[model samples]
Target: MKKPLSNAIKKIILDNIEFSTSHGFPNIVRSESFILKLMWILCLLLSSGYCAYCLTKSFQDYFSYETDTLLRFKRVSQIEFPTITICNKFATDLSRSNEVTELAKSGYIKLKSEFTDLTKFNEFFKRVDYYFKYNSIEYKDRFNFVGFDIDKMLLNCNFNFKECNSSNFKLFFSSTYGLCYQFNADKTNIRKISSPGKKAGLSLELFIGYPSKDYDLYKSYGAHLFIHNSSTIPSSEFEGISLSTGHETDVILSKTYFQKLPKPFSDCAQDSNSSEYIHSDLYRETIKLFGQYDQKSCINLCYHKYIFDECGCYYPDLNINKNLTRICDSDIGFECYSNHSASYRESKICIECIEKCPEECESIKYSLQISHANYPTPFYADFLMTYDALINNGSRNFISYSNVKESTLAVNIYFDDICYSIVEEKPSETIEQLVADIGGFLGLCIGVSILSVVEIFDSILRVILLFFSKRMN
Candidate 1:
């Protein structure tokens, strides 16, 4: 029985162990080759994991650089748009045309740059009709002008216009708060009030930059004043006014030509720039714009949608500083002019001036022309007394850089028909090479993966052949 038990244990041990004898020399070599292949596979896995970590790090760095460059481009693009949007918002308030507003959003019509001839204006306005609807924004403009860049300023604009067609085009002037004039649907006969001076609401153009397309801030082409010099130019022509150097005159009151008295103040003197008596031709003209006694018959009939400066057509108790650059006081007579803003504190046009003629003579340069060339940024009242000459058609030509004897920063940018400015530089080298290297390295990864699979297949085939040979022996 003990012998049998020992035999059973030996059989159990034999079952657990693989007892085999090779018949030929080829079998031993083949067995050894299979063991070597298994060891190689273990090494291949370890090497592959290590290489994958290194490749991941390299790709991560390349991706980071590409992302940084794209972010910078987006920043610059944002800066280019705010200026245009701001101007569009303001113009939409005055014009009431959705067609014009849409063109503004698309960034086609830059501020200050004339939208070419009227033909262009009509075509562009027609396109403006397609996108944005005619809706009035509840709020007024809020510009952060003092110490901010274009990028920082756009954060404030919240106004959107209720764009209407030329048929519904309404001009809500301050001259008569209750009445708005409906100009012809087609923008023909632009400034055709019945009279000027005693009964006119001031009409003008404020040269603001395309809030978005203002590429050069150093040059003062951002917000200029385009006053319509009624005294210098005629009501018949606005495009014919020659461009003027905005040094002395900082603004261009577009309604100057139709101001009453049609008096030209080429060599008159006045008090400080703050006095109410220093009424611009446009101011004096306001009397004629709406002061007529026809109030009984045509109280609110003809003027359906007009924007008059004297009409009190404001946003109701809004503390918004008016576009009227010339502030007034109650001191009476041709007093001095002040540069500070009116706190609603200054006096309105004197009742006498509102009802009767001036004790002295009336100003010839109606509407107003704030030429930045002559007046600089903050224009003074005394300066308006000594006027040289005014332009009638288009913009008055200024002394271009070509006309100047010496070169200057101003000249470098403002030359002939257009302003030529130098562009800022950017990093273009390191970026290009890094991008190329990433592409090459990714391609190398595919090649390495293919080679690794081929080696694994070859090793597995060798192991199978060895196993067959041993079984046959």
Candidate 2:
């Protein structure tokens, strides 16, 4: 049996194996000197082992899912202007100042008087909830009723040298900063700016009225602003740019677009249907309330879920998206929130939301270079004051220059460059590269090509067929 097998192997190597690697194996079969045979066998084994190792490495690299970044600079005639959301640091109107003051004072008093007392704690919260309900803060029209109206905040607005007004803005309520106004948020027709200078972009004259006595809760000194995509929701409270009351803020913007590989190459969402995309109930609710899914909005939604889960009721300050009828009052729900207040303070504590909400494969972002100058010089101040008092008759629609430095904020937002960057993620080892690597390694180590592999397989198949024919006979 050993003789027949040896003969068959020798036949295959001598007659069929045509590659350079066949030299060593055939030499091992035919050599008379034992030392020469041993040397040939060792060469064959070593070369084959290295080839196997190289092929294995190539396969491992292919499966590793490594990524490479490709950065490209692109120049366009025009770029879409980012959505701008402006929120008053005060968040409430001066007219409602007394109401806000009384509510806050009453809330503090109730908490101080009844929170620690187990007997009155729950009942105190019930009354606080009643007060919130009476104020209609949790009602569907709460934004219109509670937050500062945008018409009053936007004193003058011009975009692309065209006069823009309240009609150009959409109202949205922020839980952290009461009412906010968003510009260019409509995705269907986002406004684009062609020129790249302060004179060619958006110019705004804002009147941030005096802060209320109860302004401690709002926690801002000027107008909070956000720059984001028109398709996405803005988290103004977390990452807003603050404009000082007396200064002109010029935001020089540089746009950068990002595109990432999906699925095997990366975990980023490919589209709305991707498994990595946010699919949580809170995320869906956010889409229904807001327009699209954003990581910041999803995180806020998760916090809302946490609030409901912990207090057994939704907090009145947060948007109510679920069907649950219970809203937290200052008594029980507020106390529960206060207990976990540290965790709620930072939205990143919502780990599940962070992990589940994969980033969009394609997104645009603007890097801002902000600079400030004193908004109104004495001459300009006098001019504006005269204009408001005499020409406009102190029209509430324009800035009240009674205290010009304290009441006015001028902002200019524009792109600094027409050229933008496109950052893309691509696979480091594509299938073609992997195949080439394998072939190169195989040829370098064992001097074997595709024909060599095919020849060996053909020999093996022939031997099997011959043996089966003999068995059948």
Candidate 3:
């Protein structure tokens, strides 16, 4: 039964195939025109060959098209931080009998009596009797001073000292507060000071060096001569001194896609004749983006301006302290920093400016990291001992070195994946090639030419016009 059913289905398929070939399309198979038959066979063969060629060419073109992306690494200028200095002043002739008296004779210790006075002493030290019992009130106050000199201290260091030449210190301060001063002295001429309100908790940068070479001592004989006086004998002093020299910064470079490519080719290749394909003039574009300022300088200025506008004072970290009367106190600084941060997130002008900032021709994104480590831990201990001795003995002649244990920072820069834009050369068919292809297609399918198509269309239009005229008549 299964065999009979299979045979019946096969018989039906054969009958339909034979009927379609012999009866359904009998005009082509039974025609007597030998030229038409030959033409039909030629057309079929030519069309098949043309289709195969087109498929092969398309595959070849798809695989042969290639694009090359180049990666490049460049080292830009190094960025430096502000330098800090801790200076000490002596009030009496204790330098004559001190172990470090050479430092005083060498002008390391300057007589800065203006920093100490009866009013400041009385205000800081509630004991009024200690001021009178001392020989001279100024001498007693200067020798007994044990805090940072706020009023006379310059926030920016402008002195050109021969001893200190390098400027890479980010933090600077003295261990003892009395008669101690802090200032910035770096290659950058722009100097700034910590906010007055933030004097209590200032971070000191460790000065790395030998202790014996940098330490200085000043003995107040007046305080010792009067045994009944409350002032002590030995006191520590620091003269204009540099703590650390060099710093480290890490810079990492990476690549990103700046412009999008069109399908199968770059936009530049798509319109080679268009001006958009031309390389941008970097100088003109930079001027357009930043006006009169360069990229780095403009960014720095904008940041300073933003800080000043928001906080009512320029940042102490930057180089913009000209004609600025109102310096931001600690309270004002906190509020100003908060407002500036919020503006960065919500301000449209800032966002637009950042977006429009002109990038380099071979643009790369950079990430920076900074770190520091203190050297000669024992020197730091000696500094602390000196500070403690000064606090214990109001006028003790102790040696204090501004050259504390120095800190060294290491910067390591690494590059990641790099990407760049390139105009991909594509194989495009010329006008002649297009014409040949069209002609081949026409001949293969119907043995037709441009004239044949024109004649066929004209004949159809004439017949339609004749019919319309007959109907009108």
Clashes of each: 114, 1, 18
Q: So what's the TM-score on candidate 3?
A: 0.27
TM-score, model 2 to reference: 0.80
Where does the lowest 10-residue lDDT sum fall in candidate 3? 221-230
Which residues of candidate 2, in runs, are more than 4 Å off? 1-13, 18-22, 95-136, 139-151, 212-219, 273-289, 317-325, 343-350, 397-402, 457-473
How high is the lDDT of residue 54 in model 2?
81
* lDDT to native, each model: 0.27, 0.71, 0.35
lDDT tens digits by residue: candidate 2, 412-453: 999888789999998889999988988887777666679777
Instruction: Report the C-alpha lDDT of model 1 over 104-144, residue by residue, as the tens digit.
Output: 44443342243457656644443232111111121122111
What TM-scores do the predictions have? 0.20, 0.80, 0.27
lDDT of 3 by residue, 1-473 (tens): 55664565555444433333222222335456988767656755666677568646745645544444443333333221222233332222332344433433343223233225746653323222112112121222333332222322221222222122223232322122223322343333643322211121123222222223222222210000000001111112212222232332222323232232344443222222232333434223333433332334334445555677676775432123323244444345645754685676577756544443332222212232224443325565475446536654513232443232222112222222222223223345444655677666555554545765565455456556645655576
Evaluation by TM-score, superior candidate among 1 and 3: 3
Q: Per-residue error at 112 for model 2, in Å?
A: 13
Superposition error at 346 for model 3 (Å): 2.3
Candidate 1 lDDT score relative to the true structure: 0.27
